[model samples]
Target: MTEVVIAGIGQTRVGEFWDLSLRSLGVRAIRAAIKDSGGLQPQALYAGNMLAANLSRQAHVGTLLADFSGLAGIEAEALEAAGASGAAALRQGYLAVASGLVDVALVVGVEKYTDLIGPGVEAALATTTDSDFEAIHGLTPAAQAALLMRRYQHEFGLPADGLAGFVLTAHANGAGNPNAMYRKAITLEAYQKAEMVSDPLNLFDLAPNADGAAALILTRRDRLPRDFPHPVVQVAASASVSDTLGLHNRPEPLWFAAAQASVEQALKKAGLSREQIDLFEYYDAYSIYAALSLEAAGFAARGQGWKLAAEGESGLQGKIPCATMGGLKARGNPGGATGVYQAVEATLQLRGQAGANQIPDARCALIQALGGPASTAVTHVLKRAD
Candidate 1:
């Protein structure tokens, strides 16, 4: 099998982009990535998207982006696995390169949630859950997440502010990211005062829906030029897993079994322990999800994940740094584009070009994205190429 390496990465500013169409946002990111890769033409293109059909009335986004971006005849298609669509497309791209089916693959994740706006986006997000068993019962993702948070607190006998640190850390990091939607720093006091979106989850606890696109070019290490401009970031491992979609169907609703399986498999494949990971890019669409992910990924024991944040262990300078680029909280969740955004941010860190969010001597990073309520997890371990 070929060793896949990220050749280039690009992303649009994560925020309300009423001015740009879905295709335009995707094209911008794709063009930027191509330019970043020294203008190399890709043999294939894969677009990851979740809401184009529902929100923008656009489908066949893969061909639309490829043709509009001047790569008309290339093999292209859109892949969707709910919120994990971006990472699913990435998994396809990795297979394409690793199988030697395509020497160069362009993978992009783009989503437009602000086009239709308001409750429609939430309703669309709910489709990722069980339609008859969950969505039809009027359960939004946030409500489900809130249910998990309440259960976590009750099970652990914790206070209401248990997950505040996650939000604070995310906003602090996001303040440094120019492309982040909420760049302002937030404090615990502000968190305490925030309005409650649900009983246990506040406005600060949930990431908002926004418009954005992120793209990256992947190719085998030997296929690159003798002197590639940017530092090479190799795909050390790519693993994915799925669990029960309905929250109530799981044996343990709070335990992210899929996340655990994917992370363990990824770590094993990479021949690296969890301690070797210099940073983590978690799919923290909700603060509760962040804590659950840390627990499921073995960063902390169950019900002890919140302690990592309270003790400054998950901060930028802490033992297991995460959300280094604001994450889904303050960085803004762009639906399917979120997973690719995580990859792009991790690539930047591995390249030592993350500006204010850069980790010193960062050699390896673990990035994971989740579909609906931990129903699907796609995990990847990336390392600085020697």
Candidate 2:
């Protein structure tokens, strides 16, 4: 089996992009990635998108995106796994290259969520949960996350303001990222006083649904172009796992067992331990999700994740440096584009192109994506080839 390397990665500026069409956003990211990858045209392309049908009223997006990128005739496919769509596409591309089916591949994840207004977007996101059971109860994504947070607090004895630090940290980091959606640094007071989106989770605790795209060009380590500007970062492992569609079906409703399992498998395949990971790009659709994911990934004890945030241990200059890009909380969550954005940020860190957000001498990074409160989860580990 050949080792898969991320030859190049790119992402569009995240936030409300009322002007750019969905196709244009996808093309911009793809072109940037292709140019970054020494101008190596991909033999195949894969895209991850969600809510195109609801947001744009368009289907058969693969052809449209390929045509826009000037690779109309190339083999292109689109995938959807609710919120984990982007990571799922990247996992498929990694398998294709690792299995020697394709020497070079392009994977892109994009979403134009702002096309729909408030109610429309809410309705679209509701489809990710058990439509028949959960949706009937009018449980939005934030509501589900709130329920989980309530459970986590009850189970873990977490303080009412425990999650405030996480939100504040994300906002501070996001303020430094020019591409972030919410760049204003927040304070503990602001977090406590912020408008409540749900009971326990406030407005600032949730990621904004934005429009953006991200792209990654992958190839075998030995096949990279000679003029590649940075050291290769191998995709050492990738794993995806699913749980019951309904939140009530899980054995432990508060814990993300699927995410934990996926992360363990990915770490095993990478031949690395939790401590070996230098940084993490955790899915932060909500602050609670970030805490749960870190616990599931073995970075902290089941209930100790909030402590990591409170102590500034997960900041860019922290011990583990999780979500240096501000994660979805501040960076904006463009549905399908988030996982690819996470991978791209990790790649930038490894390539030493992360500007002020760079993690010093980062060699190994872990990225995880979860859909619908961990109904589906995917984890990937990347290592810089010395």
Which candidate wins on lDDT?
A: 1
Superposition error at 203 for model 1 (Å): 0.8
| RMSD after CA superposition, every candidate | 0.9, 1.0
Could you tell me the TM-score of candidate 1? 0.99
lDDT tens per residue, model 2, 206-310: 988999999999999888888788888999999999998889898888788999999999999999998889999999899999899989988899899889999
TM-scores vs. true structure, each candidate: 0.99, 0.98
Native-to-model Cα distance after best TM-score fit, residue 36 in candidate 1, in Å? 0.7
Worst 10 residues of 1 by lDDT: 222-231
**Runs off by more than 4 Å, candidate 2:** none
